[model samples]
Target chain A: MVAESARENKRVLEVKNLKLHYLTSQGAVKAVDDISFCLNRGETLGIVGESGCGKTTTAVALMMMPSPPGKIVGGQILIEGKDIVPMTETQIRKQIRWEKISMVFQGAMNCLTPVYTIGKQMMETLREHREMAKEEAIARIEKYLAYVGLSRDVLKRYPHELSGGMKQRIVIAMALFLEPKIILCDEPTTALDVVVQAQIINLLKDLKQQLDLSFIFITHDLATEAEVSDRLMVMYGGKIAEIGTNEQIYGKQGPMHPYTQRLLKATPLLHEKVEELAFIPGRPPDLLNPPKGCKFHDRCNVVMDRCKEEEPDLREVEPDHFVSCWRCRES
Target chain B: MSENIFEAKNLQKWFPVRRSITDLLKRRQSYVKAVDGVTFSIRRGEIFGLVGESGCGKTTTGKMLMKLLEPTGGQMLLDGQDVTHITAERLKTYRREVQMVFQDPYASMNPRFRIRDVLEEPLLIHKVGEDHQERLKMVARALTEVRLQPPEEYMERFPHMLSGGQRQRAATARSLILNPKFIVADEPVSMIDLSTRAEILHMMKQVQRELQLTYLYITHDLSTARYFTDTIAVMYLGRIVEMGDPDDVIDHPRHPYTMALIAAVCEPVSGKVNRIKDVPIKGEVPSAQNIPRGCRFHPRCLYAKEECWTQIEPELEIVEGRHWVACRRYKEI
Candidate 1:
C-alpha cells in the first residue's frame, strides 16, 4: 500500500543522513548511526530493532524531543518536505509538535496522572488545541472515546481505576484528540495482555483508515508489526538495514542481510513449535567504536572477505526493496 | 495425570476492603474476591502455564499454592498432603516440599543479603544452617543446577550487583536450595530483558529436568507458554476458561477468549506472509469486581447471544483428550 502511494506525494517525513549520538563520559555513543528513509502520508512505517538501536532516538529527533546529553549531531528531518531537525524548541512546540505530528509516548499507561480523572486529562489536550466550553469538551471527549471503542464512563474514573488496556485506549484517544495528520506510537501495547494488545493493534489499523492518519509504529515484536504496518523499516546500530513493504521486509523478499534472515527464522509464531528458536548470536555492536566494514559483519552467517573491509550503502536489490549488506549483491 | 505433583481444590483468597474512611470508622468492611473458587493441578517436570491479564486472579492462585499469602479458603494438596489446615510445625515440614519464584528478580531477593546468604537463609530457617561449609557447597551446587556457571563468582553478588538473568538465576538457586518437590514460579522472567528472557526459560526447563521440579509457571506471554508449557490454563476474571495440553489449547483453542489471546500473541510464522487485518476483540477487560453474570468473556466475545448474559454459567465439558472448555458455543466454533 505504501509502495503504491510512494509515487503520489513522495513522503510527508524524509529522514536524510540522520545521526544522533549520546555524548557519554566514555565517549560518543552513536545510537542512531547514519540512518536515512522516508514515510508517505497515511502509511504505517514499522521500525523494528532491539533496545539501543537508535529507533527511539529517531522518534525523539523527528519530534525534536531529545535534549541534553543526547545530541542530534547530524541529520535533516523533513516534515511536509520542510526540514525540522535544526528548528528551535519554541518553533517546534508552537508550530510542529502535536499540531502537525504527535506521538503516544512509550508506556503510555504511566503517562496519565494517577490523581486526575480521565475527563480532566482529555480536556488538557483539548484545551491546548482549541477554545471550548467544559460541557462542549465533555461531549467531544465522550464522542472520541466512542471512536476508540470505550464508553463515556471511563472519563469518570481515575487512572488507577482503569486497566492497562484502558489506559492505552485513552492514549490513542489523546493522540487523535488534536487529530494530527501523523501519529507515532512507540511500543504502545508492550505492557498489555495478548487479547488486549490485539484490540489496540486493530484499533490503530482501523483508525488509520477512518481518520486518514499516518502512523510510525516502533516495536521489537515483528509479528504484530507485520500485521499492521503497510511498510516496514528495519534499523540496526542506527542505520537502515532494510526498507520495504511487510511482504518485502518479512521473509518474502529475499533478505540480503544475514541479521534480517536470522531474525525471521528466530521469532516464535502461533502454530509452529521448534526444538530451539534461532538466536542471532553475539550482541549488537558497541556504538562508541562500531565495527569498521559492515555493521552486521560480526553476526552475519555468510560473511565474505569483502564484507569485513567495505561498508555498503543501501541500494535497490529488487524493485522497491533496498538493503545495505555487501553480500546482498551476490545473493 | 501420571506426572501430577501438585493438586489444588477450591483455591480461594479473599481480601477485606473498607468502602471509605467513614466506613472504616464505622468498622464496616466488604470482601474483595481477589481469587474466587479455582482448582488446577501441575505435573512433575512439566511447565504448567497459568495465562491471564492482571486482576484475573492468576497471581493470587500462585500465591495460594505457595502459602506465601494466607488463603481465606480452599485446600492445597502437594505431593499428597493437605496444606490448607497446617500448623507452624507442619508448615516447616511442608516448606521443603514447595518453593516459589516471584515476578521481579530485583525486588524478590533481599537487598541487604548476599547471594549465599539469601539462598542459605531458607535452609537456615528450616534448621539446615548447621553445616556452614556443606551449605556453602550446596549453594555452589544449587547455582550450577539452575545453569549459572562457575558458581563461585556469583556467591558474593547482591541483588543489585548482577544482571537480571543472573539475579533470577540466583533467586532460582535460592528456590532450589531446599530441593523442593514443587516450584510455583510466578512470572519469574517477566522483569528480565527480552534477550535474556529465553535464557531464563531455557534454564528453568533444565532445572525442572535436573531436580524433578514441577513448575506452575504463571505468565502473560503465550508464545513462551506454547514453547515451555506441557499443559496450559487460560484464566479470566478469577476462573479457568480453558485447560488441557498446551498443543490442544494453543493450536485448536476451544474457548473464544483463548483463541483471541493466542491470536493476539503467537506471531505469524516467519516468512513474507500476506497480512491479515486482525479484528482485535473490541472492549476493555471488565473489572474483576464487576464480573458478568454468565460467561466472563461475554462482554467482548463476538459470538455472545442473550443466553450468554443472565443464565447458568457454562460448565467445563470435555472436548477431546485432556481438553476441557467452559463455553456453550465451543462445539459450534
Candidate 2:
C-alpha cells in the first residue's frame, strides 16, 4: 500500500518510456507502448480494459512471471525507488515476490492446492517466508483467518470443501502474511457471487488501510473497481488509453475513451437496467496483426482521420487526468 | 387437464452419511441435507429461475429435477405422471422429454464430437427421426431455432473450432434436438463474456417462445436474471428462502439473504462509497457440513432472535399470490 500512498510523496513507482512486446511467430505485438505512470503508496491504480487489452500482460510483466511470447523489451518498474526489470527472476522471487510485492491473480483458483486444507496451506505459506516455529506459524495463520473472518477450523478442510469466497480469503491471507508493499489484485472477485464479492472488496479496503500497501487492481467489472480503486488507468490494445482519479474515471458523466464508455455501459446493474447496452461494436483488436494507429479505432464510434492514420499519445488535458485519443477535444 | 410440467411437493434430497471410522463406532450416521423440503412447480412454457450461491443446493435441486439424481424422500411429477420412482418405459419417456443445459459450455459439448455429431447424438440415442437425412434436416432446424445460422458451417466444425458463445449455442441446439418439454439451464452463460451474454440469453428466450419450453435456470447472478426469468426462487443452504415474481424478489425481497443479495448488486444512488457492513447482512456462508441453528442464514442474519435459533425449519408458505417464501421474519417484512 506504500505505492498507493506515495501520491503525496510524489513517486512510489515511476514507469518512464515503458514498452512491452510479445515476440510471437506472427510478429512483435507491442502491448504496453511507452506507458508511464506513478503509483503512490497506499493508492489503488485500476487498469480497466476488455480482455486481451494487455492489461493482464502488463501485470504479469510487473510480477516478472516468465516471458514466453511476451517480453518487456523496454520498461522501468521503480517500486519504492528500485528498478525491477533488470533484476533476475530468482532475486525477484526471493526479495520482491510476496515480501516486497504480491499479487492476487486472475483465474487464480489454480494457485490453491486442491488436496491441502486452506489453513494448513496458509500455515505452509507463513512457514516458507517467515522463519517461525510451527506453533507461531499456526498462530499467525489463525490471526489472518480471523481477519478474513474464516475460522481456524476451516484451515483443516480441503480446498474443494471450502467455497470460492473461502479459497480467495486464503489467497488474501497469503498475500498479507508477509505484508507486501504493493498488492496486485487481478479480477480477484470475478467468479464469486455478488454478496461474497462485497465481503472480499471490503476485506481488501480494510487490509489496505491497516497494511498501508499499494494495490494495482486489475478487473473488467467497473462497478467493483469503482468501489475500491482510488485512481483508475484505462488500458486498450496494450496501452494506457486513459488515467485519472477514481472519481474522475467513474463519477464523470461518461469516459473520454470510447472503449471505457462501452465497458461502463455494458455491465448490467440492479436499478439501472437498460435494454441492450451499447457495445463498442467489435471484438478486441487481435494482438497479432493489430489495427494500425489506434487499436480501438476500428471499434471506436467517435473515430477520426488522425485516429486511423497516427496512434494517439497519452496527453494530459486536466490536472492528473490523462487520456489518449486524437479527438480528445472535450474539455 | 393442465398439469404442472414439473412439480415437487415437499421434495427433499438428503445425502446419507457413509459408514466411516467414527460413524461405524457411534452408529449414528449424520445425513447432509442438500435439498430440504423444496416445493415449486414449473408451468408449461415459462422461464423459472433457481438462484443461489455455491453449495446452496440449486445445482443439486436442478439435478434432481432432471432425474440425474433420485430424491431421498418425496416425489417429482412431470405432467401428472410420477417420475421420482419411474422405471423401464416411463423412465425412458421421462429422459426423452426432459433435458438439461449445464453451465460450462466447453465441457458440456464433447471435444471429440463434431457439431453435427453433438446435436445428432441425442436424436440417435432417443431414435427420434427415421432417416439420417431427415435427422440432418431436423438438426438444421434446431440450429436455426437457436439462431445459429448458416447451419451447415457450424455442423461440420468441432467444438474447439467454435467460440464460447457459438459453442453454448451449439449446446442449446443439442438440447433442443430432443424436443424436450422441460430444460434445466444451470448457469449456461456464466462462463462467457459480458458482451455475448445478451445474445445467448435472448436466444434462450426466443427458443423458449418458439418451442413453448419450460426452463429451470439455475444461477447465482441476479442482475440479469431479473430481466431474463419470469419467476425466481432464491435458495440459501439447500432451501428456498424466497420464491416469487422476479420483480418482487429483485425489488422487494422478503428474506434477509435475498435482501443482502440485492444490496450486494444495487449500487449506491448517492455515489457515496459502499460499506461492507451496510451490505444488509454480514458473515460469509457457513460450511454446508455444519449448518447454522434454526434458519440456515440466522448466523449472518441481523434480525435473528432467540426463537429463530431453536425453531424447526420454517415451511415454504404462500406469503402472497404465487409467491412462496420460507422465513420467520416474513411477517415483519
| Segments in model 2 whose C-alpha atoms lie over 4 Å from true places | A1-8, A26-34, A107-110, A114-166, A273-282, A302-309, B1-3, B266-277, B289-293
The 10-residue segment with the lowest total lDDT in model 2 chain A: A273-282
- Clash counts for the predictions, in order: 2, 20
Candidate 1 regions exceeding 4 Å error are A1-8, A129-143, A151-156, A251-254, A288-300, A303-313, B1-3, B20-29, B110-133, B154-163, B193-195, B269-282, B299-311
- Residue B199 C-alpha lDDT in model 2: 68
lDDT of 1 by residue, B294-321 (tens): 8878988988888888777887789988
Task: Pull out the clashing pairs in model 1.
Answer: A33-A238, A252-B272
Comparing to the true complex, what docking class would candidate 1 get?
acceptable
lDDT per residue as tens, model 1, A287-310: 899898888898888899998999
lDDT (Cα, 0-100) at A162 in candidate 1: 78
CAPRI level of candidate 2: acceptable
- Restricting to chain A, the TM-score for each candidate equals 0.94, 0.92
Alpha carbon lDDT of residue A242, candidate 2? 90
User: Model 2, range A1-331, lDDT digits (tens) per residue?
Assistant: 6644545366566677778888878788877767888778777888877667777887787788747777888879887788988998789878887888788987566689887777667777787778999888888877878887788888779888777887888888888788777888999988788887887888888877777778889987676777777788988777888997766767745567777766776666766556554444446677778788988898888888888988888888777788898788543
Best by TM-score: 2
